[model samples]
Target: MIHDQSMQRRRSRIRGLFGVTAPTDAPADAHTPVEGERARLLDAIRDFLLGNNLDISAANLLAAHTAFSGGNPRLRRRIGERIAAGEAISQFWLDQQLRDDGKSDPATHYEDMAVRLQSSVERFRDTTSSARNAVVSYGRDIASQVETLAREEPAATSLLREKSQGMAETARTFEMRLLRAEREAQSLREELARARRDATIDPLTQLPNRRGFEAVFEEEFRMARSNVEAMCVAFCDIDRFKCINDSFGHDTGDRVIVAVGELLKTMGTGSCHAARHGGEEFVMIFRGFTTEQARERIDAMRIALGKRRFVQESTGDVIGKVSFSAGVADVFAFPDRRNALRAADEALYRAKEAGRDRVEIAG
Candidate 1:
């Protein structure tokens, strides 16, 4: 909703004021001091939120943090390029990137869905409470009328019959209303449950998403600690995935993703835990495996996938061999899981630099 062309006019001021550039764009010794870099990142995040009229909500801020925090180099490059080209960054664009990158949820979709569900629950509670009170009050009225009629007063018998008829009709109407309310509330409850489940799943690969992966990781971490078992975390990324997207289109690219996800998913069917970390990136946790052991397992998957040739379904064009690079780190060797994962990512980068379709183990 924050899309506006006029907002781009301020982008010129941003570039001239803050000399923020990605590592690829800067010279070898162009690194800023750590404090200076931090300040620039903070300023960039604040300016991105305020300048684009984007809300300072969790999604926006998270996207901003990821873009500037060096966690997502591609996102940073994209933002810099857009600003350099005098294009305004919109909320829609940010949300699309979030969906694409797996950094966080898109916009406020989940949060808003949660709020709506909570509101429905409260309304349902109120409706049920009101219906219960009405039933109790009606019961009291009926008892009083019955007691009076038992007094054998013939003078009021006709009036009592008329009042009893009205009460029956009123009770029927109330029951019907309560039944309708119950049905509606039940449907809403089912929808809310689905929404919660959907939030943790990746629609593209039918795999657990980043959030889902974290949940799995936390559980596995506790288990590994208790059992005194060795654990390894691997970062796997498709080699030159953008080239496939450009050559065969996103549909073929998706097939490639599905192929890799399926193989990893099969691994998860066993003791391993696998998830889609983001675009073209998958993470896996292997319990009771050393770094080299995990590397061999991942390399086997890499070789198996590389042996298969893909064809574009529409044009029958050969999409060539698809393979991925992976980096595995022994979780027990690191101080924490986060550091171990970070080391894995760094090793993955080294694997890409050395060659595609290979595996590297973090030392």
Candidate 2:
């Protein structure tokens, strides 16, 4: 009996840690071993994490639970073989994942922390309310006693005056506490908003990273679908990027990427978004633009970049010009975003095959 109780306790603790609910139904046999149930639950959790290509670290596991529970479609769609390959997930990988999802912004974390803090604030408020009520009730009781004392004995009036002075001080303290709570809540909200914006932006190019691009793409795609407007997606890659990196070193290569990003940013308007889609690659979404319009814009950018010269800072040697190739696809042409992206990729391949510095439109 003691062993059974201990096993039950262990199982309960495991369930609590994993955010799993305890079984409501009793076991068929009283002799059923608790180890079996515990192992089963643990195995199931491990399998779920591995299947989803999520890291099995404590933080990641909890994040996985939250993602699954909240039905985060972006994270859901991102699950792939790369994450499921049984490699240890490092902090860098987590950050990369965040960047990919456009969630590199601190805002999401801030929001989560704010939510938890809000709950704590609510509970504290409730407790404060109860305490305030108790104080009021006590004050009322003291007033009644003082009133009785006045009728029975007038000498107790001075003592009642002292108690009233103390009550006033208590009220002031309560008011300060309430004010502090309000300030804290407001501060947390602002911090969360700031975090979100910072997380989505890439420091190198000062542009939205892959995650940010995904967010913009999804929004633009939805808007286009609803309004029946034309939308285009373009994939741009620096031509001979490897050659640049090998010839001039990574620092110069980075400078080229930054320069390209800036140029893309200039081309962006309210209806357009430019993003750094990882190393040497960029993505642009043009709202209310057909494939041809997108192709024109991309070609223009390519030619402009080709005309611009880059000089190596250290040696003062002219590094010559940089160019890029791009593929443009009409969002409405394909059945889904994935298909459209695949088509754009194929077009990009063709552009590379034909020559390095041109734009190709998806058929």
Candidate 3:
């Protein structure tokens, strides 16, 4: 799985480095002068950056321009900030910003970013003006050839053109089906993967369910034991989840759960896995971290979630906010995974008994 992720990242980096190559029927030997055009484009972008006193490299500037032109504000802001800061372009920083922003406002952000890409397009347009003219010239040349051929061999020429047009249409239809099939296949694969994930996930919150957590817990525990390493478990429960469900509709309650789940997943990175143990309860396994580390991480997550205002999706109404109480414990103290889970649960119970929206660690 790590290898697959690494491979995908490597492939993405490679593609990013090369830029996207256009799919074409043209032979490799066909000299399209696109490489030269690209070089000129890069040079123009560098000149623009230098001319504008935007402290960005050519590649970075190009990426920013592309993102802006593609209408991504997140990217636009990122590029803008880096240039403003006089910092070197950082792909990682940009990516983290995007991830932090998450799935919300993708279209709006991208559209705003695309505006910045106009400069790149303008450069391309200028460079390709000659190419466009040449294309027109070629069209005239083809028209002259067709006329002469029609006069010399009217019947044969007419039949040939008709056959060519029919073949082209047939090819186009086939290509469209191929594209559709590819899209459908990709969708099915994603659905199948989702189903498999769902099997290991809690249906309500869609977090890794008890079964998934246990399996992962056992593996991490074993690794920790063998290495004489420290591991921690943090059990969390949404404060007043039942009350919220009772007050609001179950649908709204479900949305809250999903939002909380997302928050946990993001914040629980240091904690190996975040799982919906059952009901409003979530369990986080801090695989290779000490009790203190896990506690700090969970505390940070608790604070972040407690502060976030969750809005209702359907009507764009604010649905108030939510918070969780968590309990952290060392796995080494437990005889088994179940014992560790129980210890975390007890701590969580103590947290609820005292006050919610806080972290309580097992002594």
Q: Which candidate ranks first by lDDT, i.e. highest?
A: 1
lDDT, residue 207, model 1: 88
Per-residue CA lDDT of model 3 for 1-363, tens digit only, reads 985664444333322322222222222332445554345335434433443334575545655454433223224333433444455544566556556443332332443344455444444544454454554455555556666777899878977576555655555555555455555545655565554445665666656665567677777778878888888888787888877778666788887778778877786554378876555667788877888888888888888887888665667767576888888888778555544655666577667667788888887
Best by TM-score: 1
Model 2 residue 21 CA deviation in Å: 50
Candidate 3 residue spans exceeding 4 A from truth:
1-198, 203-205, 268-271, 312-318
The per-prediction CA RMSD against the true structure, in angstroms, equals 8.0, 14.2, 26.0
Evaluate model 1: give its lDDT. Answer: 0.75
Model 1 ranges with Cα > 4 A deviation: 1-61, 64-108, 122-126, 133-137, 152-157, 332-335
**lDDT score of residue 55 within candidate 3:** 52
- Candidate 3, residue 7: CA error in Å? 63
- Writing each residue's lDDT as its tens digit, candidate 2 over 1-363 gives 986665455444433322344533333443444554445435434544553345668866654443333222224223322333334444566556656544333444454665676667656656665666665676666667767877787787887768766875676677567566656656655675565666667778988876577688888898888988999888888988879889888899999999999999988888898987667778788988989988988888888899999987888788898999888888788656755665666577567667879999988
When sorted by lDDT, best at the front, the candidate numbers are 1, 2, 3
Each candidate structure's TM-score, on Cα atoms with residue i matched to residue i, is 0.70, 0.62, 0.45
* Pairs of colliding residues, candidate 1: none
